[model samples]
Target chain A: MQDPFVRIEGVSKLFGAFQAVRDVNLTVGKGEIFALLGGSGCGKTTLLRMLAGFEEPSAGRIFLDGQDMTGVPPWERPVHMMFQSYALFPHMSVEKNVAYGLKHERMTKAEREERVRAMLDLVQLTQFAHRKPHQISGGQRQRVALARALARQPKLLLLDEPLAALDKKLREQTQFELMSIQERTGVTFIVVTHDQEEAMTLADRIAVMDKGQVRQSGTPTDIYEYPNSRFVAGFIGSITSFDGRVTAVEGEVSRVDVPGLGTEIVARSVAGAASGQAVTVALRPEKVTLTRDRLEGPNAIAGEIKDIAYFGKDSLYRVTLPSGQLIAVHGVNAKRAEAGRPDWHDKVWLSFDPAAAILLTE
Target chain B: MRRRPIFLISVLCFGFAFFYIPILSMIVYSFNGSRLATVWGGFSTKWYVSLFSNRQVGAALLLSLKIALISATMATILGTMAGIALARFRRFKGRLFFSGMVTAPLIMPDVITGISSLMLFILMAEWIGWPATRGFTTITLAHITFSMVYVTTIVQSRLISAERDIEEAAMDLGSKPWQVLWDITLPVIFPAILSGWLLAFTISLDEVVITSFTTGPGNTTLPLLIWSKVKLGVTPDINALATIIVLVVGIGVVIAGWLMNRAEKQRDRDARLAYRANE
Candidate 1:
């Protein structure tokens, strides 16, 4: 019922002959952590820049808190951006960098210092207030950049690849820290990242982008469980797909007949495909179960394990069905699995519940 | 390897002697008791005292310092502005032409600059009737016209080497263009400006051919005085004055080298720190 914190309608950006962003429309609710996830040159950063007013939309309007911000410059808008390079002024101390925007508001010296102190404390960089950017570590610099962006108490914060500069372990740790900070501030945080795992861990809702367009927008769970398009299904997570034809539609489920496997599989289709329509059935590797003996399930296929990869926590088995379609099955490292391990060239049956498989229309 | 080092050391020593022997001999002759430069009767300080007491030499020295200071300062200011404009604003038309014009003075012969500047000033005076005579003002104007090219080339290279991200970051933090220039641009280029100013000052101070053509009776610089004194035959007083000039130049060179070395060390330290932080 409440107005969305930020609303984008028909936004498009062009750079010479290349169309960077094509008619992107989305809305972020107040206190929501939204992510724009895509690969390189997918226009995720361009969309975020347009939202922050650094880049203007060639065709569309943006509304922030019921006010239009299409023509507003970055300095005038009630928004702040954390650059991909974390463009901290190298000459200034941490305190001066954080207090920079406050000084523009003509705030008193006391008021500016107070806000700066509070922001540094919020980011836990109060002790490094006098340190220059080069004196701090990358993680500390990241916190300093965050403190500087939040010092103005912006209604919206745009982060461009917030953790891309960090190492793998540090990046993973910082993702949670960033989420906690977003929760504490309760500001609308819109993060742009090419890392899907980071988006899954940080965003409440995600818009998967490809070729300057939003392929699908949904919660992480919804996107992972039910992807509307093939791009979204392949991009968000690993998926094993098979081309099939819809046989019948009953209630909310559709029965699909797939070749090579010689099985009738039922899958849930949100797009409402008609009978006899060609469709693709996508299943996550972890959702399918692999066993030496035949297993009872709604959808089942018999195949031979072609390759086995032993991960510490689990084992991944690549199975080739009689129809020559390769499918992957992930088995957890449980007590029973330790006693009996499936080897390569072993006859295996892969089975999953019908609800676990999704029917992708595109 | 040791033999090679010895050979290189001997070559370097020979080079140093070849450059300094003539200047050192002149300085030794400055303290000579005899008026003839080749014959030294005994070491004495009479020539030094007499050189200071000479009215023409004192007046010429003062004129040279005044012209150097004024011309160098004006050239540095104009060149710095031009450098920042060219380096920061890349969209302007004829940018290449502007840059070429700035460097044209550096390669142009001193004779050409002197002749052209004299003609320009003369024509302007005849048309505008502002500068009534060819004196200190005219000489200073001429020195600045050529010295500005050197300053612009140095400052422009420094500006190009500086990171644009710093300026953009300042702007993103709500500072206007002028504020960015004042707080960020100026500070980053301060060392370059100082070095350029020193270079201009040195060039203007030592200039002979251009100053000789432009100077009038009342605007004779120190080099012009030395020239006229030499034409009258070598005098111990002139030698003493030349020795003093050489000492002043040596000290200036040492100080400038020290300042530049310190700046380079600071830049290296900052770069190392930035690299570590990124890691």
Candidate 2:
């Protein structure tokens, strides 16, 4: 069997007394746009630096395309990094900046110029080729950085916070541009960003890291729907968690008595589930349905609408349960002009399916 | 309103007069037809013509210029390396001491620096018999020692403000460490180095105290010559030489300031442009 395009074998890094990255193992397929998502100082940037050969791992090894890249320097490695600051050569023109990496290659002057021209065209900055970095707009500079990093056609491209510098509207636009460019080039990309939405939109798979450890690695939907730990659940999306103990274990499901909602909840059984084990029942806000009448069958809780936050397309309702636990319920704003919507202090029923409750053991 | 306007104008005039009166008097007397420097005489170009004819002054001027040019260039090279070492290597064992020693010359008295450097050169000569005698070499060495501190300060500040990630990015894009330094680091800090060179040149050209201690019989720089001539009382020809020196140094300083200001303004304009682009 062919090995993965990039294989990180238990890589770890130590800076003086602080361990920045710890025992990280990952395999990325060819042409995959993988994202390392985390908050500040979670080892995402450290891992990206290691991949670019800027930092050497204290333990284990990294293999790229079946080659051991243990002692390779950054210049010799067939990897390029797009820095968060863009780091475009301020003294050089955009065309020159794009052509800089190509200088090391044994190409003729005409071939180098032709390659730069084609790269600028690819990033849609052909007109700004002669302009210096400071003369162009920020978005244009970002494109110049992208064009430069892509000019050499590296086997692996690392993007550090690729869209973090742009405004929201611009970020959204560039996210699509980045994905399309990656698709066209077929180069394996590993993006490191603290922005979860950016990672979800851009990456085919994401590794959520915290405290120098990978908490979870999966598709965006898999991470959101089936988080293995409480940290992953809270990091990926908005979740309301309740402390409970398993009261009964059935064939494929379990019943948990949650004192917070003063109800016995039925949820899909997690592995190693047994009677009288402490667990957490995490539910996404959008999974719950709110109605004025009491919900029939199981998994219904009696509560009152404590507060309401109205977004343009949706309203988030904070419901206070009988046991004083406030759980959030997100409902679509299907009705126009303040009709058939629960107001503050109105009694409501929050209901969800048994399968919607994620049973997290960790 | 009348009192405020009158007060502001008086203050402005006083500041200008206090700064320019001495230089103005010197310039005016440089064209005096009389031999006495302080007396008002008819304007003539005779002192200027005599200044060109004075071979001693010509020799001293050339010597000072050569020393300044050579020392400033050498100081720039050494100082930039020291600056990069201090700024980039954060946790080296003796970094604090190294930085302190580099900056010590900035605050040290010129008399002490001159005495210490002179003693060291004398001791080295006695021990190794290398320099043989104190002359242009000792004076140039002395100038380089003190002037390097200024260059180091300028280049160090520039290196501190410059993003090191730029160098890292260059390396990541298929350039070695040396290549990154040449292609990214040096070009970014070139402006500061240039201004530092000009400052060192001016300082070396006009230095009198340290040069006095380091020079031997034949190594009389322009400043040393001026000092000796002034001891015998100032002359109109001396005034002519001073005026010429002032013009040259002033032009050099103005060009340096203009270059620094232009670089600063260009940076500001680019920053403002980037900020507006975000909006």
Candidate 3:
């Protein structure tokens, strides 16, 4: 079997007494766009820096393409990083900036020029080649930084918050551009971002981090659908959780008694779950359906609409159960008319499939 | 409605008149037909010709220029290194003391600086038997000592304001530390270094107090020459020399100011353009 393009083995970092990253082990396949998703100070950036060789791991080792990366300086590492601020060389023109890294490649002059031309064309900034960084737009400067980083055709590229500086409209547009560029370059990418939507939209796989440790690592859909812990569920998206105790265990399902809803919810059986074990049933808001008609079976709960928030395509309803617990339910406005839509203080029924509810042990 | 502050305008006018009248009169007097400075006999170029013929003042002017150029260049190199150290290295042994000492010369009185420099030179000459006599070498050293402080302040502030990530990005792009310094850091701070050099040159050119204590025979700068002549009472020749000095220094200052202003405007324009383009 071929080895992973990049492998991080039990990496850890400490700043003085503060542990910034703890025992992180990850692997990235070739030409894959992987995201390190977390909030500020969650060791996402620390790991990226370690990959770029800016920070050495306090423990463990890193290997790139079957070679040990220990004791390698950043300049000697076969990696490049697009800094968060797009740190373009302000003194150099866009063309010169793109060519700056190529100076060390030992290429012929004409070959170097051709590489720079190709890079600028790749980022679609050929028109701004002669202009200095400050003379260009922020988005244009970001492209210049990308061009410069990719000029050398690094084995791995690390991007630190590439779209965080862009405005909303520009961010959406740039997201597609970034994906297309990655597709064309075929370079393995490790992007660190705090925006969950960005990670969901951009990455093939994501590692959700908290504090100084990895909470979960999987494909975006896998992480959203089946989070192993409460933190992962909360960090990925909005979820309404209920306190429950396992009442009975059947062949492939477990019956959970939730006092909050005064109902027994049938869910997929969790590993190591006992008959009386306490657990949380986390259900995404969008997974539950809201209607005025009564729902039968263990998958349904009756509630009254306490509040409604209209959000164009979808509306979020806060439903208060008979037990006085408030639960959120999301309904898509698929129909044009509001004739049968539930409003505030109206009776409603929330129903979900047994597979839609996630059982979290933590 | 807002008031224009008429009283403030009058105060500003008074300050300008007080400062400019003497220099203006001297300039006007340099073209005097007669030797007397108080009464300007119709404009003539006689004193200007005599001033050029005076070998003493000519030699002094050349010496001052040479000293200023050499010292300012050396000071800029040394001071820029010091600035980089202070700005980039957050912690080193005696960092606080080093920064304090670098800036102390800027605030220290010229008299004290001159005396201290003179004493050090004398002690070095006696102990090491180097720099046998205090002449051009001593004066140039003294000028560099003080001029470097100004350069350090300017370069340090520039480095502080510059983003560190630019250099880091260069390193990540496969350039070594020395390559980043040469290709990235130096170019970014070149404008500040230039202005610092000009300032140091101006300060060294007209310096009197420090030069007075440090100089020995045959090291008379332009200001020192002008001072002795002034004590003997002002002459049309001296007036011509002062006017010439003022004109040269004025031109230098105007050019330096223009360069600084242009650099500032270019930076501002780039920032504004980048911001507008971002949309």
iRMSD for each candidate structure, in the order shown: 3.4, 2.1, 1.6
Flag the better candidate by lDDT, 1 or 2. 2
Interface RMSD of 3: 1.6
**lDDT by residue (tens digit), candidate 3, B1-279:** 235678788889999999999999888888899866678689899998888888998899899999999999999999999998899885889999999999998889999999999999999999998688987999999999999999999999999999999999999998998899999999999989998998899999999999999999887899999998888888888888888878887997799789879989988987897777666
| Per-prediction TM-score to the true structure, in the order listed | 0.88, 0.94, 0.94
- DockQ, all candidates in order: 0.36, 0.65, 0.68
Model 3's number of clashes is 0
Error of 3 at B81 (Å): 1.4
lDDT of 1 by residue, A71-187 (tens): 787767888888878888777899988887787887788888899999999888898899888777888889888998888888999898999999998898888889998989998
> Candidate 1: where is the Cα deviation over 4 Å?
A243-251, A255-266, A270-272, A275-278, A323-326, A336-338, B1-47, B227-246, B256-279
Candidate 1: residue B261 lDDT (0-100) = 96
Report the C-alpha displacement of residue B91, candidate 1, in angstroms.
Answer: 1.7
- Model 3, A314: alpha-carbon shift in Å? 2.3
- Per-candidate total of colliding backbone pairs: 0, 0, 0
Q: Residue-wise lDDT of candidate 2 within B1-279, one digit each (tens)?
A: 699999999999999999989998999999998887667779999999998998999999999999999999999999999988898885889889999999999999999999999999999999999678999999999999999999999999999999988899899899988898898899999989988998899899999999999999988999999999999999988888988878986997799689879988988897787667657
lDDT of 3 at A324: 88
For all candidates in order, the CA lDDT equals: 0.87, 0.91, 0.91
